[model samples]
Target: MAHEELNRQVRQDLRVTDRTSHRRLREQGSTSREDLDAVLRAGFVCHLGVIVDNAPMVVPTVYGVDFVSRTLYLHGSVASRSLVRAPESTVCVTVTHIDGLVLARSVFEHGVNYRSAMVYGVPRLLTHRTDRRGLLTGLRVLTEHCAPGQWEYARRPSAKELAATTVLALPLDEASVKLRSGPPDDGDGPDAQLGLWAGVLPLRTVWDDPEPDPALTAGVRVPPHVSGRGHRTAP
Candidate 1:
């Protein structure tokens, strides 16, 4: 999407009702749909929050977004009570990645710096066939974001399978993004003289070699995307 469109979407989505002292929290935040989309695209897993039986339930699931439609799609088993109850309730979806572990001279100053995005919205059930198709496309985009070739090589969902799944679409509004990076903020004092190993140990997500199904034909070769899988530093 265009940068201007992303800025507009962020303005519409982020509602700032409070203030804080941290410069990172106050200034380095964004609500842009593009920013959210980038965050979503960088990772496939998201934590979904909803109320079930008057209690809060947070579940982890895969998510995808449609930039043109401004819709986010989530799917799970039709028999999942959480999925059934979530559509009617307010939901918060969060995606985060830990970039590194910050080791400081002082134990109190140690922290894990990371990037994260949170989305708050009400979900609607995807009932129309056309809408469902769009959602499925979004799903494909999500699953194959890193490995572009997998969407075509993998088995596609059938009509019967689609019918047995529950997919929800939530508008990309009322969200926030916060990120922190770099070394610990240990002041120049006694702790600085401790001479401890203080720096960052980077973290990364790597894809392992793809193992084919044992019952499959022996001559099949792994798809390019799958065979060439590599590690990427999360956000």
Candidate 2:
């Protein structure tokens, strides 16, 4: 299907369902596929939560979201037991961006301004023993997602290095986005007259000057894509 058609279909399909998850905070939750896309695309890294052994684990890793295929691609060492087992069962992938600190009048009212999404699905492993081309493509996309200009700038991975890597794809069919923003909720409460200050302290991430490796060549200039982003907002 065309990208536009897929988006429309996904959105329509999402709306017809009850759209409730296990989250207790229903008011902050959203079933919009667009919101899931936005949250995933806006961030490159995610937390992969799965049950390894008898215990739960949340592994932080870089990821790429392909809207065309509606899959979330994850990469890690092939030797990792967690990576090996991720494709065998259902897992939850999450991406979150902290926008600010919500400082309320009462300690109990303190909270955070954040945009987050959680995806639940079983993953498909792509390796040299499986689909090699898909593995490379997923790795390239993952690199580009995390470091935009570095994929093309660096040399391609060798066969030996490729053997050491593993790629996993999880469909985005089951996902939800939850976001909380703006100021404190206690401004209109009885505590409003406490005379204490209470409001949101906004936070943001920005790209700073790039530092060259000390062992690098002396005359090489920083690339435009790497250098020009100083002070620019980050996803």
Model 2, residue 136: displacement in angstroms?
1.0
Q: How would you encode candidate 2's per-residue C-alpha lDDT over 52-119 as one tens digit per residue?
A: 77688888888997778887898754214665755467788889999999999899999999999888
- How far off is residue 116 in model 1, in Å? 0.4
What lDDT tens digits, residue by residue, belong to model 1 across residues 130-211?
A: 3676557655755565457878888988877666656667787667787778877885768877777788998887776677
What residue pairs clash in candidate 1, if any at all? 10-31
lDDT of each: 0.69, 0.81
TM-score of each model, in listed order: 0.80, 0.88
